[model samples]
Target chain A: MRITSQTTSDGVSEHLFTLDDIPGVIWSPSEGTAGRPLVLLGHGGGQHKKAEGLVARAHRYVKDCGFAVAAIDAPGHGDRPKVERHERLVADIRQRVTQGEALGSHIARYNVALAEQAVPEWQATLDALRELDHVGGPVGYWGASMGGAIGVPLVAAEPRITAAVLGLTGHESLTEAARRITVPVEFLLQWDDEMVPRDAGLALFDAFASREKTLHANPGRHAGVPAFELDSSARFFARHLLEDGGPAEVEESSARLDRS
Target chain B: MRITSQTTSDGVSEHLFTLDDIPGVIWSPSEGTAGRPLVLLGHGGGQHKKAEGLVARAHRYVKDCGFAVAAIDAPGHGDRPKVERHERLVADIRQRVTQGEALGSHIARYNVALAEQAVPEWQATLDALRELDHVGGPVGYWGASMGGAIGVPLVAAEPRITAAVLGLTGHESLTEAARRITVPVEFLLQWDDEMVPRDAGLALFDAFASREKTLHANPGRHAGVPAFELDSSARFFARHLLEDGGPAEVEESSARLDRS
Candidate 1:
């Protein structure tokens, strides 16, 4: 991984990094985070890792909770190489819209194909992140919309993630992924979403095998998610991940390495 | 549909039914049956309705249990028109075999694509079957392997189906369909299957939302499904579907009418 640039202000540090492949941003407690909890934040559809909301969430985790946060662009969603399938999906979606069909199931099918690629890429990125001493910490996942769908399978397949914040996604029964995830979960759903159906989102929540999961539902449209939901999510992750500082004694010798 | 030919033997009648589009066979108790149950049977990969095993199962359900049984060829299996996707899947499987890779996930993806089309066709067939006066009864589904995968979604979508026998199919995690299936399910898993991994099959069974589900696992390869499992399936359907028949009083006028 290459650290493209870093800016330190007050008690938080924002760093932009690219590994010749995965380009992402990492936020750390500027006072010096040796080995702290790492939260992987996932972005929604048509959004990038450094979206304003995600960046704010990262700052909340690092600056407020003394944790390190990172976000990577999922395949075809951000600064990644474009694939034909993504273009095809967009074209198909446009055609379907022209034909006046609801886009939920079509979008779900397309996302399933994309998530199949994104999950493994996230796994690889996680594996790579472990090489950085300061970033080696208990990992938690936070994502919604496309992020939730991708994170569901990612967390299910990767055991390192201990908890998750999933919501704002409407239903496409992905119980296969949800049933395999046993970590504590905080799921958020917009009850009156214009996009995803409420039943499908709840179905996804019901699929999670987590013994402890709280559903955060708001009576707003898809984009009208209540701000309190994020606060609840922050509290959820802090409760689960703030228990221990992993290998805090590990040296920060390679923490600031700049590959470029 | 046209009843191409009919023959009575041992107090049971076998009829070859054909439409210009769909070809299938129907077997029933020959004792002037009009109030018996109807069971839709699906054959495994590359097998036809008249395959020896399917035929035996049909006879078991028809003669032994006094239920009407029917089976139709899937879009590209049996005598139906071949789809390009099916050929591509076969080629992909062949290539994977040449490269010595695992087949379970690969097969699952291919079958998922095929089942997306198969389920709607099965729904149409079910709609047509309801028009047949002598064939109207408590509906049950019996399918194994690829048949199981297709039937899972079919039975889930068609609420008219009261019970199902699904087995030998392993992990494509079509949990969307499985979750919607609330009927009693008899799922069979081959413990030592060479093609599908055991977990995939069990995962498929686990994905089912049925409150009443019995899993029958045998220590055998894919085709090594125990002979008596069919008997168990026959009994399961009998228990669920042998009750009061549905709309059996409708006229037989459309029973033999071929749309072609």
Candidate 2:
């Protein structure tokens, strides 16, 4: 499943790398030939390589911030072989449950399995980025919704990610996955969003193992993502990936205000 | 533009009324020939007539439980005529903003316009539903996400609607369209969901001048509406639409609490 790297006429380098022998796409800036920091991007449900808006944003990050980005289509979505339609996937789960499968655990397992298969793809993309001369060292991750779900497991299992930003997604463990992630994470929450419950998101934030985590709440619906928030995400990535270790001095000073 | 209704099949005793005025297929159960409550059902963004999972669940209060249902598609989605490609739609907003249209106001207008166009279709659908002996009486409204946004304007503009149930949709008063809505409202919020911010949702809830209002907070993400919550929505709709004079017992309790 290793994807071979190819250079386009535009001089942008592309590659298919395999992890767990699973295939994934890697994109690097044309100017950056040397090693640089990599940012792994994961698409949400029913999305493919170029389908995610965040992926395009990730490209901007690579160009403006001098980082490489890698993204992969998940199982039953995008370029990945479609084993079943979304309805069929749900039906299969239902059938299995009717046949005695533990419904709750099965749902969790299904998500984990889907995430596991894509892990190698993420790893391979990371490997390709690491090989680049412009790539610094290690990598970061950014995901939205379903991609946010995968980012949790990816960061938890892979220590290579230096920082993570999860937008419009949260869970309490795999029961609510947000709680399981130990990394320095930033979560973007939508208030009146119907797709995901706010309390579940807050629970995930509460469960995060990192003391440095931050939460930003914005106004918008399921499809709304304000431009300023995107800027905030960029700032978070820059702070964690490019700046020196520990919270900025201002943040530290504010952190000490609870002494009273 | 008003659309007339016609009967499709007569021999079966239950006449099927059809309205070709709207962009998508909409149907109503022929139960009442006269004096039945009119219920309008709105589908979320990127959804069509049947709205199987989420929309269907929301529509239960109007359909299986009691109220007559009228379903319509949103703009550039479902059976509606395509206005622009997905990327183009987003790009158009950006273009408009660059030309001096305030970003928030423009988005609200775009959403309201989409809903307004669909209203004629809904009116036509209601006309068709009225053709049946089973449908009569005051209209009630129900919608989730984008549907909620549309319902807000529709209920405000149309005095025919007696009540409404809006779920999982809200934003700041950045748009004038949002400011016009005044209705008996119920808001469902997810604290951690990233698609919409809770603060923005709360602000919208506060903006409503409705004497009757309810807010529910749960744990979930933009895509994670658990089965239990779906059932709660059914109850919510039933309380407003199906109950004898709008759940007298609960209202009394609420009133008592208010006085206390």
DockQ of each: 0.01, 0.01
Q: Which ten residues in a row have the lowest lDDT in candidate 1 chain A?
A: A251-260
lDDT of 2 by residue, B33-89 (tens): 455565677877677755676335524443434445556566676655677544365
TM-score of each: 0.47, 0.44
For model 1, the superposed segments whose C-alpha errors exceed 4 Å read A170-173, A244-260, B1-260
Candidate 1, A1-260: lDDT as tens digits: 88899998666788888865878888887776577788999899889998989988887666545678889987787788777988799789989899999989888887788888888888877777777767776889998888987888888999999989887665445778788989988777765677788668767876778766655555557787755455446556766787632211110111121110
Q: Per candidate, chain B TM-score?
A: 0.89, 0.70
